[model samples]
Target: MHSAIDAATLRAYRDTHYRVRGDTPMTLRIDQPSPALAALHQVHGVDCSAFITAANPHSRRCGDDANARRQLALAQDLERMGLAAMAAAGEHPSNGWPAEPSFLVPGLSLHDARMLGEKYGQNAVVWSGADAVPRLVLLR
Candidate 1:
């Protein structure tokens, strides 16, 4: 079964686990969600929504080649959704300088973020907090 997470919990988690950064107005990444998560979105009237992830942007684990592959994969996913997305190599707010660039999407509301997390089976959802801090919500 799915569960809910409050804002305070999310905010604390982000502060403790990730390197939070200021909002990057023009950049974001949409990671591919699992099949169950995709199905949950459809049921919730989110016909097309991208699953965002929080990761250290400065990590070199993936390298240049892997980064390109991820971009290509995300492009394909967006295409399937019939949505236009742009990919760029830049420093993202939450992730830093990711090996793979992230797809730029509009900022979402807290409500939307929660819904996305609930459906995506995410352990948590991270977004820019009111004071510009990175906030998170643990999902179980």
Candidate 2:
């Protein structure tokens, strides 16, 4: 259950607001059960989802262009996999970090979510099961 990510960064991930964008935007908090997410899951006919991003790999800040490119690649990869994705952002409540473009991928399994996290060099991903309780899944 351990990862190479540092404690501060791990704490930051837990504190991040994983915002799912739309006309009625929803901010998903770690370890919190979201009614909005439960409704979203009902819409998608899914029992689970994941909040993933392709920015600041391994907790290292990168240029906007690089982050954008990585984000685009992740979108493409998800498209190729035939998965559903909603535009989202990883925003720190205190503005300690820049809001990173992210995705709320409905129906993405926990295993696949972890794989995508590893693929994009993320330290962790926010995942929710049938109960809609998002947990931080750490990756090295």
Candidate 3:
């Protein structure tokens, strides 16, 4: 029964992800790129694309809330590091791969993301599906 909306706790949760993954400069994935990431790319300088699959084609149509917010945070984190992201979109899970991230950031690995989602956790998780492994490329 986490609050899922406390800023202080949220920061701690996000920090935990970095801690477990290590702060080293590494590439990470958002499992599924969201509108926020798209906005970052369009204006904030993120280079994220969309991750499509046979089950979920037409990346736009596959857009979900959980994935979108994760992508947004990831884009924001990458922006802090001055890294550019590209939205990965395609018809195959492996088709639009943007390089295996140093750390794969997915809601499936919610031990950390969930903690980070203390203030924004949702039933619509970003990495709960069999094909949900979209991540952010933490370009070096």
Candidate 4:
């Protein structure tokens, strides 16, 4: 509801790649339609997805230990919610920022996605619908 994130940081979120890794990988770009994501959704029988992380909360850099703990906690939360989450990362193409550990959660509702992002103190999360077009959902 409140937007305090700066323009440059917001731009970076848009430019970043939200990658879901495994045997078959997916690179999701904000505002771009991804066939791989569509296929993943179909496989999961879900029409919605969210790419989220708890690392570097509020965009402030933290130690690996701290980041890892936060990320693990988020994963646990997802597991407790019974949502199927795939290991993923948010990467900046220019290598300006270290890849943040993330998850691609199929069937996550938009409301829940926003809640998680804000709960984790994130500026934004990448989300998609049945159209498979990833969008930058800000939570600041």
Candidate 5:
């Protein structure tokens, strides 16, 4: 089995690079707004206030088709900004733990993320968050 990352190491990296919002940690802030947000707003017509404020926010609550589409749009916008992305997996079939794949940017000092992706059998490192963290896309 692959060695698990130490909590301290993970905590230190997150504390230095991410902001904690409620229970979820926020990473990858958008330096500028993108047109995808506008398109999402027009298409969905739902209150995407949280997304607007957070920019390229990661949502783990995408439990339906519509929510999945919204998450994809947000992830695509982040990719357009030239940020790193990963095709995160959902729960493993054998174990209930998260099997999500992820990768850090070229210089983020988080080698553990890439290693974790490898451990989970997701070897592709791409530039779309949908590939990394969206539940619906992961199922597909």
Candidate 6:
């Protein structure tokens, strides 16, 4: 089962609490879902949807070297779904995001981050929350 959180609430929190700065890539740690891995279900959740719908400009502030990539891969495996499914569920590319989150200050590499999808066909990695529950970030 999946729960929902208001996208507006998340957006306000991001704007007031997680504003990004500079060109250095930033990392947003969104939590994974409960019970078991549920990428699709998680994406459909309110918080995840808010991030997916949020704006992304510049589109080069989010990525992962190898550790972040590997971590996300593990999460993907736990979800048991392909990139396409995740993208469809979240309404974005499954490869990853195209930029760092606008809400957070740049230069923070969160190992807990995950590559949810690629935006506009770019090699970007969307950051996830660190909480145990599922979460998403609105990166730009």
Better of 1 and 5 by lDDT: 1
lDDT against the true structure, per candidate, is 0.40, 0.91, 0.31, 0.90, 0.29, 0.30
Residue range 1-140, candidate 4, lDDT tens digits: 55799878888888898888986698999999999999988988999999999999999999899999998889888989899788999999995799999999999989999989988999888889999999888877
| RMSD of each predicted structure | 11.4, 1.1, 15.5, 1.3, 16.5, 14.9
Please give, for residues 1-140, the per-residue lDDT of candidate 5 as tens digits. 22244444233222221121322223432233324433433434422212121111132332355445554554554466554433322222332333232322322112332333333332222221321221111100
Residue 115, model 1, lDDT? 58
> Per-residue lDDT for 38-96 in model 1, tens only?
34334444433332432222222556665566556556645665654433333334533
Highest lDDT: give the candidate number.
2
Clashes of 3: 24
Clashes of 4: 0
How far in Å is the alpha carbon of 26 misplaced in model 4?
Answer: 0.9
Model 2 residue 8 distance off true place after TM-score fit, in angstroms: 0.9
- Cα miss at 124, model 5 (Å)? 24
Error of 3 at 64 (Å): 0.3
- Show pairs that collide, candidate 5: 86-132, 87-131, 87-132, 88-101, 88-131, 88-132, 89-100, 89-101
* Model 3 TM-score relative to the real fold: 0.24
State in Å the error of residue 131, model 1: 15
True-structure lDDT of candidate 1: 0.40
Model 4: residues with Cα > 4 Å off, grouped in runs:
none
Q: Candidate 3: where is the Cα deviation over 4 Å?
A: 1-63, 93-140
Model 1 residue runs over 4 Å out of place are: 1-60, 89-100, 106-140
lDDT of 3 by residue, 18-37 (tens): 11123222221344334433
Give lDDT for model 6: 0.30
Q: Show the lowest summed lDDT stretch of 10 residues, model 1.
A: 24-33
